[model samples]
Target: MKILLYFEGQNIIGKSGIGRALSHQKRALASMGIDYTLDPKATDYDLLHINTYGPKSLQMVKRAKKLGKKVVFHAHSTEEDFRNSFIGSNQLAPLVKKWLVALYQEADHLITPTPYSKKLLRSYGLTQPISAISNGIDLKKYYPDEKKEAAFRKYFHLSETQKVVICVGLFFERKGILDFVEIAKKMPEYTFIWFGDVPMLSIPAAVRRVVKKDHPKNVIFPGYINGDLIEGAYSGADLFFFPSYEETEGIVVLEALASQQQVLLRDIPVYDGWLNDRMNCYMGNDNQEFEQLIRQLVEHQLPNLSMAGFKTAQEKSITQIGAELKAVYQEVLERPYDHQIYAKVTK
Candidate 1:
């Protein structure tokens, strides 16, 4: 069956989690031998899978429904995840939640990154059928390489002996940027680098202040590094320090695992059943604990968690995710079309 996979406002999402997830999806679809198109107007496609809820996507959904095409909505954003994301995100979160609920209720099937996200969507009172799937990692793109590591270290002017702890995400409060800065302050000896974007005009004043003025001397905010350099950063860093307070699924964590870097993360509910504390990663509840864990990792008190994490990453590889997606599409297509049921449920 032909499928059209599309994300509205994709160009604007640049280097963000949503963009990365869409990129992974495209690769997965191609690997599975699935015939797919990015063009929404493509007539040959039997299914429309949308990954965003912008005005264009909403219009496409309505058009697809009218044409009797199977519709699948990929849940990449929720109200809870939007808070603290940008300048007005918190204020606009409730409205966004309402909009998402209305949009997702119209889908024939819904898919999210994790069970935690599924529960959150249900909490929003969406009764539509939902499935949890990983935003799987591309192992070939992200793996340990000494040559790349050396080049990265040389380019960044990082010394051979410096213990580099890195976090990759947009500079948002929900990502634990403040906590990361605090932890860096506590550990003056280690080099803390955050490789992500912080659009000066879009971020909140508080977050902007922190990114510009409040950070510790050792903390580095090299905003919006390219994909190849990011791979290099993952390979070169000693530990992937992600103190994010919230996430539907932390794709960077998986990338770090694929690169064989030890992970340190906040003990958040989103990682409930997936990341095991002290097994594949080190989890901390607060700043003090985070600092302690970092010290433990640096002083050789903790075992190498890279292998365990790598195994988990392997399990959630793009190839496996593609198979799951292909099966879901087949199951969806085999069933009878029921626009009446969709209309009733949406109403």
Candidate 2:
């Protein structure tokens, strides 16, 4: 069946996790030869697959339901992940949750990136069906590349002998940016790089303080980047250290794994089932633990789990994502359309 793969306000979401996830879904659909349209106004599609929680998406949901169309709402942003994200975000979190719950409750089906998120959404008292799907990775684009690695080092002016640790995310407190900076300070011998940025006005004052004035000399904030440089960062870096406090599912983790980079992640619920400590990757509970783990990795005390991480990335390949999405679409189409699902909002 044809689908309308829609993402509202994409211009505002540039290179963010939600935007990246939407791109992955498009590639997945293409690989499966599924007919789809990005146009929300397209009249030929059988289903509406919305990837954002904006006002436009909420309106589309209402309009689609009125037309007796199936709506698959992707639950990319939960209130928990929204807190500490921007200036005044924590204070606005309750309102965000209310809106999110109201919007998601109207969906015929909901898709989230992990079971942890599915559980979290259920806790919001949502009775709609929810499926956990990976924001799959493109292995071909992110695999090990020596030439790109060399270029990344040359461009950054990093010496070959210096141990490099990298994290990729927007300058959000929830992404553990403060912890990242602190950890970098603890390990002065290693060069720490954070490859993301947000407008200073939008960032919280606390995060802005650390990013602008308090960060140590060993830390480098290169702002946002992509293409060969980023791909090379994943491949060439000695460690992919992500201290994010929350995630529905981190797409960067998948990219790092696909690139065969050794990953170090904060022990968060989102990675509860798949990622194990010291198995496919390393895990740390806090900044101190993260520092200890980094030291162990540097000393060769920890074994190379890059190959194991690569195997995990393989499981979430675009082809697999496509097949799963197609199955979900088929299931959605075959199920009897219940007009009553629209009753809550219509009233």
- Cα lDDT of model 1 by residue, 223-260, tens digit: 88876677888978878999988899988998999998
How well does model 2 score by local distance difference test? Answer: 0.91
**Model 2 stretches astray by more than 4 angstroms:** 343-347
Q: Give the total clashing residue pairs for model 1.
A: 1
Model 2 Cα lDDT, one tens digit per residue, 214-276: 999999998889999999999998999999999999999999999999999999899988999
Q: For each candidate, how many residue pairs have backbone atoms clashing (under 3 Å)?
A: 1, 0
Evaluate residue 298 in candidate 1 and report its C-alpha lDDT on the 0 to 100 scale.
Answer: 73
Q: Show model 1 residue runs off by greater than 4 Å.
A: 341-347
Give per-model TM-scores: 0.96, 0.97
